[model samples]
Target: MQKEEFIAIASKVSEGLATDQQKQLFLYHLGTFAKENPEWEKLDLGFRQQIEDEIKSDIRIQVFGEAKWKPKTTRLWPRIVAIAAAVAFIILGVYFFNYRNDKHLDIDNLVMQGVGPGKNGATLTLADGKKILLSDAVKGQLANEAGVSISKTEDGQVVYKVVGVRANEAGKNNTMTTARGEQWVLELPDGTRVWLNSASSLTYPAFFAKTGSRKVELTGEAYFAVAKDKLHQFIVKTKGQDVEVLGTHFNINAYPEEESVKTTLFEGRVKVSPFYTQGEALSEGEKATVLKPGEQSVLANNTIKVLPANTEQALAWKNGYFMFENENIKSIMREVSRWYDVDVIYQGNVEQKTIEGTVSKFKNVSTVLEMLESTKVVKFKINGKQIVVMPGKDNN
Candidate 1:
C-alpha cells in the first residue's frame, strides 16, 4: 500500500475506528520495520514517533527486504502506548497491559525460598453430613444421595450425575471446599462445568431447581461455563452479589475477605446484582445489571462499577499461571499464600511495592518468589508454613 493509504488507516487505528483486519495489516507493517531496525533506541525521538515515520516509509523497500511473516493482532486499544505495549508483549511472550510504574527493583540483592505449589485436592461434604477427602478417594463411586451418583474421576474432578430424579430435597445439597493449597473442577448434574481455585468452596444442589433456575452458592474464585437451558437460568449467588445467566461463560471472585467482589464475563453475557444490604430480603422482583463479554463488574462500597476487562489475565489461573500487572506486593503475596498454603507476614511498610509479570503456578513457590525478587523491590523468607516478606537488600 502507498504512504497515504497507510497513514489514513493508521490514523483510524489511533482513533479506535479501524477494524481488527485493518489493525492486523498496520501491525504487520509496523512490527516488520521494528524487527528490522534493532537500533531504534539509539536514534529514538521517542519510540512512537520513530515507529510512525518508519511504518509510512519503505524502509524495507530501501533494500526492499523480503517479507516473511505477518503480525497477528491479539488485542488493540486507541492509544499509541497500548499499541507499543501490545507489540512488545508479542515479542516477549507475555500479555502486555499497563507497564510497571513503581520504584525499580534491585534484582541483584535478593533472597529466595523453595516451597511447593498447590495441587488438586478438595473435600466434598455430602448432604448426609459425611465428609469425603477427594484427594484420597480412589477413582470410583464416592456416594449416592437423592438418586444422584457422585464419583471421583481419574483426572481429579467431582462428577454428579442424576440417576433417577431431579429433586431439591432438603437434605440433598452438597458442598465442595478446597483448602489453602488445593483446587478442583466440578461438573454439575445439568452439565455446567466449574473450576474452583485454591481456598474456595462451591455449594450446589443435587439437581438444579425443579421449577425456576439453577442456583449455587460460592466462596472464593471460580470460572463457570454454564450449560445452556433457556428455560431455566443459571444463578451464582455469593455473599455480596448474584450473577444470573441463561447460557454464558463467566468468572467470579467473591472471597469474603476481599473488599469487593469482582465478576468478569469472558464469553456470552451475565446479569450481576450487587447487594446493598447484606441479608436483605430478596423477592422475585429483585433486578440486576447486565454485563457483556470483555466487561467486568466490581461490587464495592455497595455500588456496582463496570469497567473494561482483561479476560486473558482474569483467566490466567485456570490456564495454569498467575499473571499480574502493576499489582502491589501484599496482593501478590496473598496469592502466593493461598497457592503455597503459607501465611504471609509483612516485616514493615511494603505495600507500595508492585510488579508486572507472568509465571506458571505449576512451578515451586521459589520460582515465583525469584521472579518477584528479580524486580529488586522486595525479598522473601520461608519459615515452615509462614512466609515473611521483607524489604530488599537495597532497602536494608
Candidate 2:
C-alpha cells in the first residue's frame, strides 16, 4: 500500500475508528509488508513527519483546551513542548512494545497483589493423650510433650524443642500433632526444619544419632528445609510413598482426600516413589506424583496431575496465607474447613463454580465466606462449626 494509505489506516486503527473492511485490509497489508521487509523498514519520511506534526498539533490543542489561559511567553512554550516530547516518546515506546517483556512486568507487585495469609486455627494433642484447644492459645510456649518443649511464637508459629535429650539418642522417635485449624514448626536435631500444615503430624527423633539417615513420617502437608548432611540423607514418609533428599527445600502434599500424593522439589534433588515401587529421582523444579499402582502419569486426561511448583502458591499456608488460582468451590471449602476447624456440607451442587483470588486467613470466617458470596456464585450459611454451601439462584 502507498505510505499515505498505510498511515491513514494505521491512524484509524490507533484511534479505534477503523471499519471492519478497513481493519481486515490493514491487517493483511501490514502482515505482507512485515514479512517482505523483515529488516528495520523505515516509514516514508514524509509520512512520518506528517504524523509527528499531527501528534504535536493534537497535544497543543489538548493543552490549550484544558489550560486556564493560552500560552503567552516563549519560556512557557519550551516547558510545554518538553512535556509533550516526553509523552510522545512514551506513547511510541508503548506502541512498539518496547517495555512489554516479562522483565518489565514488576513481578514483586504481582506477588504482593496475590498473596494472602493462611487460616491459623488448629487442635493440638498433648503427650498425655489429651486434646488441647490451640486456636486461641497465647502466642508463646504452650507446653512440654514427651521431653520436647512446645511453644507458640509471637508470630503465631508453634515451635518444638527437645529438652534434656542426650546427643547420642537424638534419632529416637518423638512426635508432634496438630488438628484442623492449626500448624506447627519443628526444628530437627540435625538442624533441619519442618513446617507442618493443619491436620498434619510429624514423627522424628529428638536428636541426630549420626548412625543412620534422618527420617520422619508425615500424615498431611508440610514444607521442609533440610540442613545439608552429605553423610546422612533426610527421608520423609507419607502414606505409601517416600521422599529421600540429601538437603533441600520442598513441599509435600499428601492429604488423604487428595487422589495423588505430590512431592514438589523447589531446590536440590529428591527421590520419590511408592513404598513398593522402584521410583526415579527428580531434580529441582520437578514434581513427582505418586499414582496408584498400574496407573501412569497422563498429562492430557489424568485428574491427578503433577504441576510445576509455584513456591509461593504451594507453601502459602506455611507462610500464613490462603492462595487459590481457578480452584473449584469444593477444593476451596475443604481447605477452609481444615484450617478453621469447621465441617463443610454442600446443600446443593456448589462445586460447579471455580474461583480465583487470595484472601487473608486472619480475617473472620464470615468475612471470607461473604467475599466468596460476593461472586454471586454460591451462598454459605454458618452453623456453629459447620458451613452449608448452596447454589445461588442468580449464580447462573
Candidate 3:
C-alpha cells in the first residue's frame, strides 16, 4: 500500500469510519508498511503522529474491545522516541482477530450497581497476635511493635518506621494479609516497598538483624522494590522456592492453588533456588538459577525453569490492570475471582480458550466481564456473588 493510502485508512479506522473490509486490509498491510518504510521520518509530521496514534488505538481496542475505544490526543515526542513506542506495541503482538462491534452487554441491574473492584485494604497481625483491620484503622500510627512504629498513611499505605535500635527486637515478626477483593502496599522497616495483591500475605521481622539476610515469607502474589543494601541480601521464601537478591525489583506469584511458583525479575538480578524441607540440606552443586531483568523462573515439581517474561503482564495487578496475553480462561478467572471477591462455577461443557487484553482493575466487575465476553470465546452469568461461566454464543 502507498504511504498516503495507509495513512488514510489508519485515519478512518481511528475515527471509527472504516468498513470491516478496510480494517481487515489495513491490518494485513500493517507489517508491510512497518518493514518497508523503516524511516517513519520520511512522512509528514502530522501523518507520522496519526499513524502512531492509530497503532496505540489498535492496541487499546485489542485490549478493551471497540466498545471502549476512545480517541485520545497526545503530543508527539521526538521521532526516535515516538517511533520506538509504536514499534514496541507492534512487537508485543496486538491481535484484532476477535473485534466485535456488537458485544457490549446490557448488564443486569444487580451487576451494574454492585460487585465493584478491589481496594487498598488488609489485616495486620502483630507478633503478639493482635490483628488490626487496616481498612478500618484511621490514618497514622496504629501500633508500636518491637523497635518499629507501624502506621497507616492517609493514602492507605502501611508503613513501618524504626523507632528504636535494640538487639532484643530482632525476632519480632509481623504479618500483613489481604483478603479477596483487597490489595495493600507497605514499606518494610528496611525501606523495601511491597505491593500485596488480593488473597496474599507477607510476613517479615519487625527489625532486621545486623548479621543475617532480610527475609520474608510470601503467599499468593506481590511486587517488591527492595532497598539496595550491599551488606545484606534480601530473600523471599515461598512454598517450594526462595528468591534471593542483594537488592532488586521483582514479582512473585506463589498462590498455593497455582500449579507453579513464578518469580519474575523486573530490575537487577535474583537467584531462585529450591526450598529445602526440614532436615533437608542443599545438595552439593545444586546452584540457583540467576534470573536477569525481564526473565522469569518457574518452580514446579521441585525444579526451576527460566524463560523470557512479559514484565508488564507479571506486574499488571500492581499497576491496576488485568493484562492478559493469551492466558487460559481458568487462570484468568482465578484472578477475577480474587479481585471481585466472587466464586466461579462452570456450567455444562465450557470450551477451553485463551484470553488476551487489558482492563482497569478499578472498574466494576461488569465492565471487565463485558469486555471479556466480546472475545466470543466465553460468556458469563452473574448469580449473587457467584459467576457462572458458559461457552460463548459463537461456540454454540
Candidate 4:
C-alpha cells in the first residue's frame, strides 16, 4: 500500500470514521509493511513512532470498545519496537477475530445475553457426612475433626491443621468437591497444596499417617504441589492409575467422560502405575510409567503412553484461561461447558476442526464464544445456560 493510503486509513481510524472493512485493511497493510521491511531503521524515525502509537491505540479501542485512538507524541520509539508492535497487533487480531472477509460477520449473534464464568467455590464433606458450603462459611474454623482443626482461610482455601491430633486420630477422611462453575484450593495436613478445577473432587484424611504414604483420591482434575517428605511418599489415586511421588508438582485430568487419563508432571519425579487394590500388587500384566519434568503420561484401555507435555496448556484452568493448541472443537466446548456451567448442543454434524489460541476463562461465556466464532470455523448460539454449536460461515 502507498503511504498516502496508509495515512488516510490511520486518520479515519483515529477519528472514529473508519468502517470495519477499513479497519481491517489498515491492520492488514501494517502487518504487510512490517513483514516487507527487513531494515525498518531505514524508515523515517518520526513515522515509525507514529505507526507504533496508532497500532496500540487501535487495538485498545477494538478490544475495549473505546471511542477513538489518541496518538501519543511525547517520545520517539525505536524502529524495531514499532515493527514488533505491528506484528503483535496482527497476531492479536487473528486470535480474537478473523479480519479477512469479516465485514458482515456478526460477533454479537452468539451472545444474546451473558452467562458469567466460574469462581472459587466448593463443598467440604466431613467424614461423618456433615456438609459445609465453603462459599457461605465464614473465614475461620469450620470444624474440628479427629482433633484436627479445619478452617477456611480468608482467601477461600480449606486448610487442615493438627492441633493435638494423635497418629491414630488422623485417619478420619474429609472430602472437598467443586461443582460446575466452581473451583477451589486446599491445603492438606501434610502441607501439600491442591488446586481443584471445576466439577472435581479430592478425598483425603484429616491428617497424614505418620508412618505410611500420604494418600489422596482424586476425580476430575487437580494440580498438586506435594510437600517434600523423604520418609513418607505422597500418592494420588485416580480411576485409571496411581501416581506416587516423594515431592513434586503435577496435574492430573481423569474426568470419566474423557477418553483417557492424563498425568502431567511439572517438577520432580512421578511414578504412574496402573490402579490396584489397596493391598494388592500390580495385576499380572500391568505396567507403570515414570514421568520426568515436562513429560505427560496417558492411560487408556489399560495401556499407558508417555510423551512430551505442554505444561502451560495442561495447567491453564488453574491459571485462569483456556489455552488451546490444535485442540478439536468438541474438546474445546467440553472445557467451556465445565467452566461456564453450560450444556453444549450441536446444531449439525460439525466438522472435526481444531483451534489454536488462548482465552480468559473468567470472561462471560459470550466473550469466549465470540473468540471461537472469530475463527470462522465454528459458531455458537446461547439459550439460557445451553450453548448450541454449529459450523461457521466459512466452514459452511
Instruction: Give each model's whole-structure lDDT.
Output: 0.71, 0.57, 0.73, 0.75
Worst 10-residue lDDT window for candidate 4 reads: 74-83
Output the TM-score of candidate 2: 0.57
Which residue runs of candidate 2 sit more than 4 Å off their true CA positions?
1-171, 277-306, 394-396
Candidate 1 lDDT over 88-167, as tens digits, reads 33222223222345454444333335567787889999887899999999998999887788998776688988888665
**lDDT of residue 160 for candidate 3:** 88
Candidate 3, 201-222: lDDT as tens digits: 9999987887778999999999
Evaluation by lDDT, superior candidate among 2 and 3? 3
Q: After superposition, how far is residue 95 of candidate 4 from its true place, in Å?
A: 5.2
When summed lDDT is taken over every stretch of 10 residues in candidate 1, the lowest stretch is: 90-99
lDDT of candidate 3 vs native? Answer: 0.73
**Ranking, lDDT, top scorer first:** 4, 3, 1, 2
lDDT of 2 by residue, 220-284 (tens): 88989899999888889886667788888788877878656767766777766454324745432
